[model samples]
Target: MKAIVLYQQGGIDKLTYTDYATPEISETEILVQVEACAINRLDLRARQDRPEVDPFPHILGSDIAGVVADIGPRVSEISVGDRVVLSPNISCGQCNDCTDGNENLCSRQKLIGFHTNGGYAEYVAAPANNAIFIDQSLDFSSAAAIPIAYLTAWHMLITRAKIQPGEDVLILSVGSGVGSAGLQIAKLTGCRVFATASSDQKLQIARQMGADFTVNYKKVDFSQFVLDQTNGRGVNVVLEHVGQATWQQSITSLAKNGRLVTCGVTTGNEGQIDIRKMYQKQLSLLGSALGSSSELRTIIQLANNGMLNPIVDQTLPLSKAQLGHQILEDRSNFGKICLSPTLSAE
Candidate 1:
């Protein structure tokens, strides 16, 4: 098998496409012939060895769309030759959080491409439970974009914040995959959505995705815009994934009793907050991780029904996985960057 292996974590240069041994599937696992994979911010962080380091020669791609080559014993729901999308979140099904239907909070949780080998290869082994069968109507590239970004946004907005209709929602970095997903979800909930982007081109895309208001953060203060738009009341909810860079402002741009949910911190993770303001405003801060399998299923249904759509910036062969990472790191793309592993020539 040919894979984009991280010989040593540092930069995009470390991601080399090379021949590697195919993984042997466990009795409870399935062998998936990789079709497409998506690049994520976590991939950049993993490449730089910031959060942590995966073992050398690591395959780093979380969201995947592929065909099942073989199914392990006891996997009764799905069978071989099934077109599927990887769930990305792997959790201990018997844990307390998992039993409580909060698998995203499970103590034994591990994200593929982060904690274990991922789908940056021609084939990979995954637990049968982590495979979601895609409807034949969907393409592999679109299926590959769903697992991480959409699921994360769904969990943060719907599950964590419980966003309501007629409310106002502010999303940071609206050009991002999760940000685009957040915009669509907020609009679907009948909320007036405001989004911030670094460029006017990106802001236009955000507006097209259903954001009621778009702010070019490069030219104006987004916090002021939010306050002015809400007549000094601030938004009802803030979708914050950009982290420390926007953390304080996100809190400040919220209405009284507003909910703020965050998933990742791309910028350095150190921000000061006003405790007095938090207390006086009665603000609620929530931290969300990857979403549950049920949430992924719901997102799939939404995609199928045309209620939600994954924004794909570009598609490349898996051999150019490093290039995909570069594009993501530079923020040069509007949405998810996809890699087709099957197209790689070993």
Candidate 2:
């Protein structure tokens, strides 16, 4: 089997494509023949030796879509030859958080690609519970892109913020996978959506995805634009993922009692917060992580029903994993970048 191995965490160049022994499946796990994998900011951070990186020679990928080659002995719900999407979130199912359906917050949680080997390879063995079966109608590329960005956006807006129809929502960085997903989810709820991107082309795509208004943050102050558009009331919800760079503006663009839910900080991590403003406005600041398994299922159902879809920017062979990582790091790609493990072996 061939895999993208991080020989040493330094830069995108460290991601080398090489052959490796196939992993053995545990009793509760299933062996998946990976077809497609998606590039994520997490992958970039891990490659650069961010604090999130595990031990050396790590396989970095989280979003995977593939076919089950074999199932472990106790895996009763799934079988061999099943088409599946890997969930990436691994938790101790017996823990209190897991039992309560908050697996993302479990104390023993370990995310694939971050803490363990991931799907940047021909095959991966994951817990049977982490595999979600997909119908033949969906292509592997689309299925591979759903696990991270879509799930994170669903958990932030729908689960945490409780977005309602007619409400105003502001999504930052419309070019990002999560940003695109946020736009689609807000639109699905019939909310008036405002999205920010770095370029006119990306903003146009956001409009096609149902953003009511688009702002090129590189050209204008997004917070002022939001206030101007809403007659000073500001937006009802702010879907934020960009960290220190946009945090202050996101807060200022919110109306009184507005909800701000965020999951990632691709920019800097630390930011200043006005305690007085927070209290006076009675604002709700919610920090969300990757969603639960249930939310993943809901996102898939939404896709299956044609209410949502993955915005794929480009697809490359696994040997070009370094190039995919470079595209993500440069922030030039407008949506998810997918990689084909099978093509990497060629």
Candidate 3:
């Protein structure tokens, strides 16, 4: 099978479209013929500096939608030719966290692309438990766009923050996949959504997506904007993932007793916070990881029901995945970048 394989981590030049051996699934795993795979910021960081446990000659894509080409002997529910998407997080089913329906917190959790080989190839294998059959109406690209970003957004707002209707919430990086999903999620609760972006064009789309207010962080100080808009009351919740660069400001933008949930630190780690302000405000700071399998199922159901829609901005063939990475790095695209593994010539 042909795949975009990286023998070493550094820049886009490390990725090469080449042939690799097809994986042999274990008794409980299934083989999927990759249709579409979504590019994420994690892919960018991985290319720059591969994470621990990542092996060389690695295939780097997390969210995927594909057809089941084969199933292992123990796989019962899934069948050949079923259209499906895999939940990126793999957890041991018998663990305490898994039994408690908190699979995202499982001690043995492994995110597909990060801890294992992923879907940036013509064919890939995954645990049968991780595959959720999708309705025929949804395309591979849209399905591929759901797992990581939407699940993370859903978990951040719905589970961790426990956002309620009429509450005010601020979403950072309104053009990001998570930001776009966060805007819709907040609107679903009838909450007033405040969004931030680096440009007018992205801010306009945020407004269209039901953001009550949009700020260009490049031009104005977003924390002050939030305070001014709310008359110094701040928002009930703040969805922050941009890490060190936005940490203190995100804390500053929160209302009294407000919840702040974060998933990633794209900027840099090691953010500082004022101990006095934290105690005085009585704020709740939470760290969110990839969501549970149940949350992924809910997002899938919502997508199937046409309530949730993932924004896939553009797609490139598997052979041209380097270009997709460049688009993400440059932050030029709005929603997501998809790769069609089937488009690669063998």
User: For each candidate, how many residue pairs have backbone atoms clashing (under 3 Å)?
Assistant: 0, 0, 0
What is every candidate's alpha-carbon RMSD to the true fold?
Answer: 1.6, 1.4, 1.5
**Tens-digit per-residue lDDT, 1-346, candidate 1:** 9898888888788999899999888889999999999988988888887555555668888999999998888788888899999999889999889988889989888888888889899998899999988888888888898899999999999999999999999999998989988888888889999999999999988877788988998898899999998899999999998888888889889999999999988887787779898989999999999888999999998887777778889889998887898888888788899999766444
Worst 10 residues of 3 by lDDT: 48-57
Model 3, 1-346: lDDT tens digits are: 9888989888998889899999889999999999999999988888788566376778888999999999999999999999999999888889988999999999988888778889889888899999998998888999999998899999999999999999999999988988888888889878999999999999988887788899999999999999999999999999998999999889999999989999989898888888888889899999998888988999899898888878888778999988999998888777888999766435
TM-score rank order: 2, 3, 1
- Which residue pairs collide, candidate 2? none
Candidate 3: misplaced stretches above 4 Å?
Answer: 343-346
Q: What do the candidate models score in CA lDDT, each in turn?
A: 0.88, 0.90, 0.90
- Note the residue pairs that clash in candidate 3: none
- For model 1, what is the alpha-carbon lDDT of residue 111? 87
Which regions of candidate 2 deviate over 4 angstroms?
A: 344-346
